[model samples]
Target: MTEIHPTAIVEDGAVIGENVRIGPYSIVGPDVKLADGVTLEAHVAVAGHTSIGAGSHIFPFASIGHKPQDLKFAGEVTELIIGANNQIREHVTMNPGTEGGGGVTRVGDNCLFMVGAHVGHDCQVGNHAILANNATLAGHVELADFVILGGLSAVRQWSRIGTGAIVGGMTGVEFDVIPYGSVIGDRARLAGLNLIGLKRKNLPREQIHALRAAYRALFENEEGTLRSRAEALAAEQSDQPLVKTVTDFILEKDDRRFCTPRSED
Candidate 1:
């Protein structure tokens, strides 16, 4: 049985799954689909062609599935697909994709979108990602699994943050961040490997050691382009998955400059 407050307005075509609870004054639009165990606190608005997966809890004042903020959007039918068990905090705003892009904004499971966080249209957020308070992603940005954006961090449009990467508070990332990378500072230079994160995950010590060596070989090799070093590391550390992750990200072709340590210059 779904529990909907009398003050809430659930449109006729909206699909409400069992065990869902909608609080006072919340509005579920006609095209919205809320799966089982979803809890919408008061004053939340879920609109557009949005499908929020099971076990998701949305706090008050969240504006979800809104139209894209892009100027080219002309009322096209786009969608926002949020996976299961996400905790969307107060004042968070998530927009649907734009037709100019892929027409879909996808967020993976177990994400924590903190208060005032914003996910722009067409952004793809991976599982277990954490967006700290006011963290923002511009359109078409991709965040791999286990990535964390510290408070007030923002990623520029079309930039990709690889798996296990962390961007520190108040930083603006305009480049692609490598996997297991830690970046900080304004305009965000890569600080180093995410050693603490790897340790907490209990990756084998040997693998970690290999990753450290690979990092140095890839970044410290001042004689060649990053692509060349990445290719060399790929050949040398084929057995080390973590090392391969870093190298593969370097090999990815994108317009944004790769984030590198400050000392690289």
Candidate 2:
């Protein structure tokens, strides 16, 4: 049986699964659904056509499943789909999608949205990602698996953050971050490979080494061209998984929002 506080307002059409808990003063809107073991702390509001997966916990004052803030939103039926085991901390906000940019905002499993983090409409956030305090993702953003956005960082609309990428604190990212790479500062130049993160993820030492070499070749070498270096490395280290990953990332990047290397003066 679901446990809902007396002060909580759960609309008629809302579905609350077994063992779900709705805390004091919370509101579950008409089109909302909370799966088994989901918990919403005090003052949380879940609106629109939203579904929270099992074992997810939303902290106090979090406002999720809100309508898109986009001016293009026309009261259409959009959705916010959050996967299991996500931890949404206090004051966080996640908005649903708009018709112009699909009709759903999706967040995968085992992610963490820290305090004051905001995920704008039409964003696709992958599994095991972390949005630190005040990290904001604008509409139409895509964060691949294992990506981390540090505190106060903001990613622009239509940008893609590749798998295992890390954006440093207070950075302003206007471009797509490369897979397994790190970006930092105002314009968010590519810092280097996320060595610490890769190591923590238990990637093999040989793979890490190969990736380090590939990073230097693509970003630090005299050639200063990612395509040619990536191609050569892929050919030379065909058997290595890291080399293949690098090759795939460089070749598959969408032109709109790719990270820029620092100018060599």
Candidate 3:
């Protein structure tokens, strides 16, 4: 049985699953679909063609599935697909994709969007990711699984944060962060590997050590261009899956520059 507050406005065509609870003054649009166990607290607005999966809890004042902020968007049909078990805190905003941006924004399961965090149009956020308070992701940014955006960190449009990376608070990330990388400072520069994150994941000590070695080989080697060195290192470490992930990330083509360690480090 769904529990809807008297003040809530669930449009006629909105699909509310069993055990869903919509709080006071919340609005669920006609095209919206709330899966089982969804809880929308007071003053939430779920609009557009949004589909939120099961067991997700949205706090008060969240604005989800809104129109894209892009100037090129002329009310074209787009969608926002959020997976299960997410915690969307107060004042968070998630926008739908624009026609030019593949017409969909996808968010994976178990993510946390903290207070005031904003996920822009066309962003793709992976499972177990955390966007801390006021963390902002510009349009088309891709956050791989286990990535953490610290408080007030801002990622530039089209930047990809690889798996297990961490962006420090108040930093501006303008490049693609490599797997397991840790970055800090305004106009963010890579600091080092996310050793803490790696440990938390309980990766084997040997694998962690090899990933570190692979990282240095790609970034610190001076014998040749970084790309050539990455290729060579990839071949040498072909047996190590973790090393392959790092090397493949470095070699992957993208418009954004790869995040490199600070010169002072």
User: What TM-score, to 2 decimals, does candidate 1 have?
Assistant: 0.97
Give each model a TM-score: 0.97, 0.95, 0.97
lDDT of 1 by residue, 148-223 (tens): 9999999999999999999999999988899999999988998898888899999999999999898888777786
Q: What ranges in model 2 sit over 4 Å off?
A: 222-224, 263-265
- The candidate 2 region of ten consecutive residues with least summed lDDT is 256-265
Tens digit of per-residue lDDT, candidate 2, span 1-265: 7899999999999988999999999999999999999999999999999999999999999999988899889899999999999999999999999999899999999999999999999999999999999999999999999999999999999888988999999999987777898999887999888888999989889889988887877777877456667678878888988778767777775344457577431
The reply for model 3, stretches above 4 Å from the true place, is 254-256, 263-265
- Give a tens-digit lDDT track for model 3, residues 94-206: 99999989999999999999999999999999999999999999999999999999999999999999999999999999888989999998889889999999999898999
Clashes of 2: 1
